[model samples]
Target chain A: MSGATPMLELRGLRKSFGDEVVLDGIDLSVASGEVLVVLGPSGCGKSTLLRCAVGLEPLDSGEVLVDGNLISATARDASLRQRVGMVFQSYDLFPNRTVLGNVTLSPMVVQHRSRSDAEEQAHSLLDRVGLWDKRDSYPSTLSGGQRQRVAICRALAMRPEVLLLDEVTAALDPEMVREVLDVVIDLADGGLTMMIVTHEMRFAEAVADRVVMLDQGHIAETSDDPPAFFRDPATPRARAFLSTFDYRRRSGRASGSLTKE
Target chain B: MGGAEILFQGETISRLLSGLMVTIRISLVSVAISIPVGVVVGIAMSSRHLLVRAVLRAILEFVRVMPQLVLLYVVFFGSATAFGLDLSGEAASVIVFSLWGAAELGDLVRGALASIPPIQYDSAYVLGLSRMQTFVHIILPQALARLMPPTMNLVSRMVKTTSLCMLIGVVELIRVGQQIIDFNRFQYPTGALWVYLAIFVMYFLVCWPLSIASRRLERRWAA
Candidate 1:
């Protein structure tokens, strides 16, 4: 991991909202084509970490590097943004545009792709996510699952080097969650670089090349083998977090099964 | 009241109809000028910088609180007295209404911009849009959709507000109606009521459709 240059790197990242520390001084890196899944309870700053990585949130004092180059948060760097695509939990598709329009927007506007080429890429991506039929549809007309898929297509259409998904399935219905997770699994299988923030243990286990459990704005545990992490977490905090899920699963209260695919 | 009487009412009706045309022309031109200026002001108000937003808000507040008639008077008189600019009543009415319309629509646009969820901005940022691209491609399109109802409502109000231009002696529908009444006060006796009724009907015919359109837009947005 140290020999190869990281595709994405965060060094000494720190963020705060008023006096409440959301992300303490932290360092994280992801190698090329690696899937790093971040896991934590709410308020653990997993989402903030992703946000800061993409320059959506200004860091208090830190640096973010993409493929060994620093990116300025204030500068209007179209290429810098084009390299790091993100999909939100809310599926924030531009409601004013059609599905094709939403997906092709960045490619045409930022990358300066010709309309024909952008639409070509958009069509392929949409087809991959099984949303080709909904190409002309507005976001409001789609199901939760379908909209999330379109959101994924919109990000992938930019052809970024690294993709960040912040709890993409958190807003979906239980039945809808599988379709989105399946897309992530397919992306991971295709060897796309991804950093995902999610609470779905089974999906994370299936897709993550490495799993890091965040606690109180800090990395409490990291495991290269997600299965081992679930079976037996080394850190007490990781164990405690897993145990709550375990208890929930044993009592048949967990909405979805925790079995590894 | 009927088609024959309406069409054959002669010069009094003809003059009033011509005034109606002037009113329509002013209202349309005012809307065209106001909406774009209003959108600019609205976007300025939505700036992330507190200082910029505050300054624009102060100016918009002044415009909002001041009466349109007073603004007309100020622009009509002040330009002449202070700058020695002899602005015609039509030009003065345009300036005053455009200012007022821009401020009202600007506030509406500001509200629409504010109403957009923060996630939209984040999404646009991640997709690699520059600030301007985000606004043009993402923010403005969505905001414009949500802004339609309020904007149309303001346009109708601006149409009605054009009547205030009569105070400055521009020959719009209201002004022409008053002239017709004065001309016919003794000869026709009850002609004043007819002229007033015609003005009322004209204003209603112009504004009622816009109100309906505004409501329709609101319902579509809700859907």
Candidate 2:
């Protein structure tokens, strides 16, 4: 543990799926209300680390603290998970639910809020994500971009201290990626503390306060000057990663090496 | 007695209606009893534990492959001989139908549960939803939506399958139709045919809306 006591902190976090090590001795700290972005090659343990920090995976060894409170430190993940929120790549909204229903579900179910209040909060979140017009629409009825946005609203409805985004816009079409990123940028501007795993170098450069590039389950580089990192990467892996950013394909199809085919 | 009236006359109509009610009663009761059982059993079959899953899968498969008529006979006749306790024809029908419905419904539930993306589970945990919260708020809703169409289809089939209960003397619509035919054997040769056609129309009316609902729901799923 550091003397400074960051809002979100990890110390020697280690995780493995069977024999394959997803994260090995990883460590980082984000100050209160920091917008941090993590970038890495495909399957380089970025998502796994996010999962561990958010309590989705049981860490083999290490400690995770949220606002100086223990969340997942080998024995007590179930208690600490409530303070963190995460958005998925596929926008895992309850398909049976409308946009409002997706956002209101946890508050209504876990927080035991009245339906009217939950729906009211849900509607405000939908409005924030610019999907208030589509609140009654089922997730299947919405466009990919809209669904991802609704997913964001669903997470935001939890009022979490730290929000985690894992390739949220990757599932979107190229043209629609901007709309989702624009919403994220808006959130960042509002000083929402976030840890985003993203491939959108341009968006990350614009919005993120700091960027961490991981290779083989280790932080290869960390830079606050996003433009400098893009222009002159300190590490070879970071250069290889940034070079893949293509501004050409209009559909956000990820013209890079990690094209989700 | 009359030229147009047969030996049974309109007797078949009244008996058939009574029988249809009995059949519907059995199906509804059985299905109500079966839903929870099927869901739990199917989940056990799909469980991560090898021994538990093996046992559940073996039993479900054995039951599924066995003939319903045979099971009905066992429940109707075997229970009487073994326990010296006899159930009424309708009660027997309900029990047998429940067993069948549970097996089928459980399979439907299991399939629905399995179809959910693993990522959804990951999302639930990451969102800080507790275990119970995930099941109630996340797993159940998604499974219910996935299972509805198939379960509705099975219910229609179950309604139609009640005809088989006549073999056990349950006095369902088919049994009533049979009794009327026996009485009017000499009067009208094809009276049975018209009665059957009426029954077919009634079944169609009962099932058509459910079928339509299932299809619409499926289309919505794709959307």
Q: Which of the numbered candidates is closest to the native, going by highest DockQ? A: 1
The worst-scoring run of ten residues by lDDT in candidate 1 chain A lies at A245-254
**Residue-level lDDT for A42 in candidate 2:** 96
Candidate 1 positional error at A197, Å: 1.0
Tell how far residue B66 is off in model 1, in angstroms: 2.5
Candidate 1 structure quality by residue, lDDT tens digits, B1-223: 3223332466877888899998988888888999999999998888799999998889889988888889999999999999999999999988888888888898999999999889998899899898889989998988999999988888888888898888988999989988877766666666666777888888999999999999998887773
Q: What's the fnat for candidate 1, on a 0 to 1 scale?
A: 0.93
Once superposed on the true structure, which residue ranges of model 1 sit more than 4 Å away at CA?
A72-76, A248-261, B1-7, B48-55
- lDDT of each residue in A1-261, candidate 2, tens digit only: 136668788889998888988788999988777899999989899988888888777889998889888774543444466578889888688877788888887777767789999989987888888889998888877888998998888888878888899999988899999999999999988888899999888888888888899888889899987888878989888887877774555775655677566
Query: B1-223 in candidate 2: lDDT tens per residue?
Result: 2333442466656777787888788888988998888888767766789998777677777667888888888888888999987888778878877888887887788888888889887777766667677777788778887788898898888898888888888888777767777777677776667666667776787789889999998776664
Residue pairs in candidate 1 whose N, alpha carbon or C atoms collide under 3 angstroms:
none
**What residue runs in model 2 are displaced by over 4 Å at the alpha carbon?**
A1-3, A74-79, A114-117, A246-261, B1-8, B46-49, B220-222
> Would you give the TM-score of chain B in model 1?
0.92
- lDDT for position A201 in model 1: 89
Task: In angstroms, give how far residue A205 of model 2 lies from its true place.
Answer: 1.1
